[model samples]
Target chain A: MEPIIKVENFTFYYPDSQVPALAGINLTVQAGEFLGLTGPTGAGKTTLALALNGIIPNFQGGRMGGRVMVAGLDTAKTPCARLAGVIGSVFQDPEAQLVAEVVEDELAFGLENLAVPREEMRQRIGAALEMVGIASLRHRSLRELSGGQKQKVAIAAAVALRPRVLVLDEPTSELDPRGTLEIVALLQRLNRDYGITILLIEQKISVLAPRVPRLVCLNKGRIVADASPRQILAQEKLTTELGLEVPPVTALFRMLRRAGVYHGDLPLEVDEGQRELGRLLGSRASRA
Target chain B: MPGKSFLHKLNPLTKVVWSLAVITLAFVYQEPLPILSLWASVLAVALIGKVLREILPAIRGLIIFAAIFFLFQVFLIDEGQVVFTLVPGTGIGRITDVGLKACTMLALRMLAMTSTIPVLLATTPPKDMIVAFVEKLKVPYVYALMLVTSLRFIPTLQEELSLVIQAQRAWAYDLEGRNIIKRFLALIPLALPLLLMSVQRARTMAISMETRAFGAGPRTSLHTSTFQLLDIGVISSCLLLTAVLAVVSLR
Candidate 1:
C-alpha cells in the first residue's frame, strides 16, 4: 500500500515551552488504513494528530523541524484551507467545534469554507449526514442534540468534503460508554465500508483495540511501539510501564499465562478468551 | 422560546430596525401620556408576537427599577409647587408636582425603551440575528461568527460558572459573606477558573475552525437570509411610524 501520510524526523515546540511537544517523530500511514493512536496524557499524540491536518506549523506558530506530508502535499507548504479538502479533522469537544446552530448547516460548514458550489454542497451535506446516520437530525438545533448526536454531526461536518483521511482527536473521551461505542462503530464502518483512512486518538485501549488493525503508542514525544493491536497489547510490561490502561481481557490472559494455567495466544475479545479457556479445561480434564 | 409567529417570521434585520425605531420614538415625547401610549403599543406588538409571556419576567425587573427612578426624581428637584410635605418644617421632605410629572414621564420613557429590546430578542433566534448582521448589514463573517459562537456558549459558560461556584462552596469558601467587599472577594475563585476554562475553550475552538478551513477565503453559507414582502412591509411601517413620531414631536 502506498503511504498517503508521511512524517519524517518531525519535531515541534510550542511558544514558551522548554521542550518540544513532538520530538524526532517518524511515522507513515498507508492509504485507507485505520490506525489507532494511544498514549498517556502529554505524550504528543494530539501534536502528531494536529501535524497530520497541517494545524501544527500552519495555524499554531511554533519552532519546528522536519516534515509532514499528506496526500503528496507537504503540510508545511500547504495552507490549512487547501489541506482541509484532503484531511478532515474532528477535535475532542463537539461543543467548541460547532459553528452552526443546526445539523444540516454544520455539515455544510466545511463545504462552504471550501466554496463548494451550491448544488454540490447540497448533495454532499445530504450524503454526509446520511453517511453518519444523522439525516433525520437535519433541521434540529444544536442545543437540542444529545452529546453523541452532536459528535456525529461534528464528524459529518468533517467528512462532507469527502476527505481521504479523517483525524479524530479523542473523539469519544467525553462520551458515555454507549455513546463511545456508537462513535467507534461508526468510525469502523467508515473505514471498512467507505475506504476512508482513519487516525483515531483514544485513551481506552479495549475500545480501540477491536476496531483498528494497527496500534501506535506514543510516549514522551516519541513513537514507542508500532504494531498490530494484539502485538502492542501483548507487550504487557511495556504498556504497563508506559502508563497505558491494558485491556482487561488482554491483562487477564497474560496473568493466566504467567500462572501456568493455560496458554496459546492472547485473546482480544470475550469469545476468543472463552474458547481458549474451554480448550484448556477439556485438555486438563482428559489428562487427569 | 423558539416559536413560529408573525414577529419570528419577520426578517431579523426588519425586527432590529423595528426595535430601534420604537426605542428612538420612545424618547421623542417628554409628556407622560405619549410615553405610556408607546409602551402600550410595544406591549401590543409583543402580544401579537406571542412573546409577551416570555418577556414579562425581564419587564417586571425593569418596572421595579423605573419605580426607584421615579422616587429619586420626586425628591431631587424641589423647584415646583409642593404636592405634599412629610415634615411640615423640613423643606427637603417636600414633594414637588413638577418633579412628579417630569419623573413619571422619564420613567415611562425608560420603560418603553427597555421593553423593545426584549420584544426583539425574545422572538428572534440569536443565530438568525447574527446571520442578518452578516447578510443584511454586510458585517464581516469573522465578527459574525464571533458573535454567534459567543452567544452559543453563554449557557455552557453559565453552567460551568455555577459548577465553579459549587466547587468553591464545597471547599468551605464563604460565598454568603454579609460584607460587600468580602462577597466580591469570594467571586475571585469562581471568576479565575471560568476565565481559564473559557480561554482554553477559545483556543480549541480556534484550532477546530482552522482545521475546517475557516478564514481561508471568502465563505459561502448553507443558510442565506433573504428579504421577503413581509420584511418590506414591516420595515416600511417602522419608517412611517418613526416619521410620524418625528413630525408629532416637532409640532
Candidate 2:
C-alpha cells in the first residue's frame, strides 16, 4: 500500500518549555488505513496528531526537528491553510470547534473559507450530512444539539472539505458509550466506503482494538509499539507497563492462557472471545 | 426571535436604517404628543413583526426606567403653576404643570428612541445582521465574525459560570447567605475559573478556525442578502418619516 503520511525522526519542543512534547518519532500511514493511536495522558499523543497537519510547527510556535509529509506536502514547510485541503482534523471538544449557529452553516464555514464556489459548497454540505446520517439536523441549531450530535456535526464539517486523511484527537473522550459507538462506526464507514485514511487518537485501547486493524502506542513522546491490534493486545505485560487499559475480554483470554486452560491467539472483542471459548469446549467434549 | 414577518423578510440594513430613523425622529420632536406618537409607531412596527409578545419583557423594563426618570425630572423643574407639593414650606419636593409636561415628553422621547432596538433585534438573526454589515456596509469579515462569535459565546460562558458556582457550592462555599459587599467578593472565586476556562476555550476556538482555513483568502457566504421590494419600501418610508419629522419640528 502507498504511504499517505510519513513522519521521519520528528522531534518537537513547545515554546517556553524545556521539555520536548514529541521526540524521535517515526511513523507511516498507508492510504485508506484505519490506525489507532493510544497513550496515557501527557504522552504526546495530541502533539503528534497536531504535527500531521502543520499546526504543530505553523500555528504553534514550536521548535522542531525532522519533517512530516502528508500526501507529498511537507507539513512543517506547507502553510496550514494549504495543508487543510489534504488533512481534516477533529478535536476533542465539539463545543469549542463549532463556528456557526446552524448545522448546515457549520459545514459551509470551512468551504467558504477555502473559497469554494457556492454550488459546490452546497453539494458538499448535503453529501457530508447524508454520510453522517444527520440530514434531519441540517437546520437544527448548534446550541440545541447533544454532545454526540455536536461531535458528528464537527466531523461532517471536516469531511465536507474532502480531505484525503482525517485525524481525530480523542473525539469520543467527551461522549457517552452510545455516542462513542456511533462515532467509531461512522469512522469505519468513512475509511471503508470512501477510502479516507483515518488516524484515531485515544487514551484507551479497548474501543480501538476491535475496530482498528493496526495499533500504534506512544510513550514519553516516542513510538513505543507499532503492530497489529492482536499482537499489541496479546502482550499483557507490555500493555500494563505502558499503563494502557487492557480490554476486559483480552485480559480474560490472557489469564486463561496462563493457566494452560486455553490456547491460540487472544480475542480482542467479546464475540471473538466467545468463539474461542466455544472451540476450546468442543475439543474437551470430544475428549470426554 | 426568528420569525417570517414583513420586518423579518426585509433586509437587515433596512431595519438598521429604520431603527436609526426612529431614534432620530424621537430626538427631533420636542412636544409630548409627537414623541408619544413616535413611541406608538415603534410599537406598531413590533406588532406588525409579530414580535410584540416576545418584546413585552423588554418593554416592561423600559417603562420602569422611564417612570423612574420621570419622577426625578418632574421634581427638579419648577415652572408654571405649582400642582402638588410634598413637605410644603421648603419647596424641596414641589411639582409644577410645566415640569409635569416636560418630564412626560422627555420620558416618552426616551421610550420612543430605545424601543426600536428590541423590535430590530427580535426580527433579525445575528448571522443576518453580521452578513449585512459585511456585504453592504463593507465591514471586514473578521471583525464581524469576532462580534458575532463573542455574542454567541455569551450564553455558553453563562452556562459555565453556573457550573462553576455549583462546583464551588459543592465545596461548601456559601454564595447566597452573605451581605451585599460579601456577595460581591464571593464572585471572585467563580469569576477566576470562568475566566481561565474562557481563555483556554478561546485558544482552542482560534486553532479550530485556522484549521478550517479561516483568513486563508477571500471568502464567500452560503446565504447572500439582497434588497427586496419590501426592504426598499421600508427604507423609503423611514426616510420620508425622518424628513417630515424634521420639517414639522423646525416649523
Candidate 3:
C-alpha cells in the first residue's frame, strides 16, 4: 500500500535563524498505522508535526529543503486549508485551539469552514462528540469545561473534519494524568475502530510505548531511532544519552538484566513486569 | 443569561434595529417629558424581556453618570428663573429653571440612548449575534468571528491578569502599596507580561484557526438566523413609533 505520509530529506529554518529547526529528515507513515514520535525538548518533534501539515514552511514562513507529502499532496505546495481535510492537527494548548463558545460549535467550526452541508455538519458534530465520549457536554460552554474536557473538545473539533490522519503535538502535556489517559484511550479507539492513522508526539515514551507499535525518536532535528517500542526502549544507553525518559518498568527490567538475574525482554507496562517477576521467582524457587 | 422571553427569541438584527430607533427618537425629542417617556419605554421593554433585574447594575451606573452630567449642565446655563443658588449673591453656581429643564432633557436622552445597549446584550448571546450579523447584515464572517472571539477572550484575559498579579506578588512585587506612584509603577510589570502573553496567544490562536481551514472558502454556518414574523412585527412597530415620536416632538 502507498504510504499516507512521506517526508524526504526535509530540513527547515525559521526566517533569520542560523540553525535549522528540522534537519535532513526522512520518514514515511503507512495508512491506518498508529505511530508515536518522542524526543527531548527542542528535538524538533513539533517542527516535524507542523511540517507534516504544511504549517512549517507555508504558514510559518521559513526556508525549507526537500518535501513532505500527505495523502498524495505535497505539504510545501498544497495549502493548509486543503490539507486540513486529509490530516487533522491538534496542538498543545486546549484553551488556545478552541475558537468557539460552545462545544458543538467548536466541532462545527471546521466543518462550516470547509463548507460542509448543514445536515452533514450536524451529523459529524454529533458523531465526533460521541466518539470523544463528551456527548453530555454538547451544549456546554467551553469556559465551563475542565482542562481535560477542553482538550477533548479540541480533539473532537479536529476529528469532526473526518480526516484520514490525526497528528497531535504534545496534546496531553498540559493535562492531568487521567486526562492524558482519556485522550490516549480515545486516540486508540479512533485508530482501531475507525482505521484512522495517528501520529502522536510526546516527550515521554512510557505513555506511548504499550499503545503504539512503532516509535520514532528524534534528536537535534534528526531521526535517531525508528523501530518497535521494545527495540527502542531496550537501548537504555541510547535513550538516556538522547535525554529521553525510559519507562520505569523498562528501566527496572534493564537493571535486572545487567545484574544477571533475568534474561527476558524488557516489559513496557507494569502488569507485564509483575508477571515476569513472578515467573523469575518461580523458577528460582523450583531450582532451589 | 440565556432566557426564554420574547425579546430573547427575537432575531438579533430586529433588536439592533429597535435599539437604533429608540436612540434616534431619544435625540429627536427636546422636552424633558418626551425624553423621560422614551427612557421609560426602554425600561418597559427591558421589563418585558425579563432582563430588567439583570440590567439593574448597568442602569445604576448610567444613572450615576447622568446625575453628574445634569449637575454640570445645570450650572453652565443662566437663562430662565433661578431655582436655587449654591453660593448666594455670587453666580458661581446658579440653578435656573431653563437650565434644569435642558439638563433634565439632555440627561434623560443620554440615559435612554445608552440603556438599550445592556438590554440588547443581555437578551442576545454572542454566538447568535454573530450569526445574525453574518446572515442578515451581510457582514463578513471573518470580521464577525473576530468580534466574537475577542469578546470570548475577555474573561480569559481577565483571569490571566489576576494570575499575573498573583505571580508578581509571590515574587515580592507589591501592587497595593500605599504609595500611589509605586502602585502605578507596579502596573508596568503587570502590563508587559500580559501583553507578551496576549501576543503569544494570538499567534497560537491564528495557527489553530488556520489549521481548521478558517479562511479556506465561502463558509456555511450551522446555526441559521431568519427573520420570523415576530421580528418583522417588532421592527415595523419600532419604525412607526419613531416616526410618530419624530413628528410630535417636531411640532
Q: Report the number of the highest-DockQ candidate.
A: 3
Which tens-of-lDDT digit does each residue in B93-200 have in candidate 3? Answer: 898988888898888999999999999999998999999998878899889999999999999899999999999989998788899998888799999999999999
Q: Which rank order by DockQ, best down to worst?
A: 3, 2, 1
lDDT of candidate 1?
0.88
lDDT per residue as tens, model 2, B115-160: 9998888888889988899989999998999998998999999999
Q: Each candidate: what lDDT?
A: 0.88, 0.90, 0.91
lDDT (Cα, 0-100) at B46 in candidate 1? 93
With a 3 Å backbone cut-off (N, CA, C), the pairs that clash in candidate 2 are none
Off by over 4 Å in 2: B1-3, B71-88, B91-99
lDDT of 2 by residue, A1-288 (tens): 558999999999999889899999999998999999998888899999889978888898878999899999998888888988899999999899998899998999999999899898899999999988899999999999999999999999989989999999999999988899899999999999999999999875778888898999988898889999889888877798788888898899999989999889889889998999999999999999
RMSD vs true structure, all candidates: 1.8, 1.8, 1.7
Per-model chain A TM: 0.97, 0.97, 0.98
What is the alpha-carbon lDDT of model 2 when measured against the actual structure?
0.90
Could you say which candidate leads in lDDT? Answer: 3
